[model samples]
Target: MSIIMQYIFNGIFDIYSIQSNYYFFLTNLQLTIIVTCTLWALCMGYG
Candidate 1:
């Protein structure tokens, strides 16, 4: 029973870590897009 509980806890931790990583990656991607768009606008003499 204890071993099963341990495995469950480990699984939950792994899932949480994966979710955090995915969130971080998405945030970085959004930031990159924004920066790229801003640069493009500046280069085009719009901003």
Candidate 2:
């Protein structure tokens, strides 16, 4: 579980680091929002 979280965070940071344009930034922002919602739902379900 810790490893999975680490991997997800790393992926998020990597995506942020690679963003170099407005379009890419907007897409990444959308992706981040989606991932955040999914993680929140999983936590609420498990908690």
Candidate 3:
């Protein structure tokens, strides 16, 4: 009853948090890669 509902709610929350963290990490990684590429291009006189 209430315990089962609580467990379900907790599971959903855990999953949501994990998903958000994963997306955050992915965004940071993409930004880092883009910055690195841009710097490399500038160094090579392409920019």
Give lDDT for model 1.
0.97
For model 3, residues 5-46, the per-residue Cα lDDT tens digits are 999999999999999999999999999999999999998996
State the lDDT of candidate 2 residue by residue for 1-47, as single tens digits. 99999999999988877765667879999999999999999999999
Better of 1 and 3 by TM-score: 3
**Which pairs of residues collide in model 3?**
none
> lDDT of all predictions, in order shown?
0.97, 0.91, 0.97
Q: Assess the local accuracy of residue 1 in candidate 2 as a C-alpha lDDT between 0 and 100.
A: 100
Off by over 4 Å in 2: 1-20
TM-score of 3: 0.90
lDDT of 2: 0.91
The TM-score of predicted model 2 comes to 0.56
Error of 3 at 12 (Å): 0.4
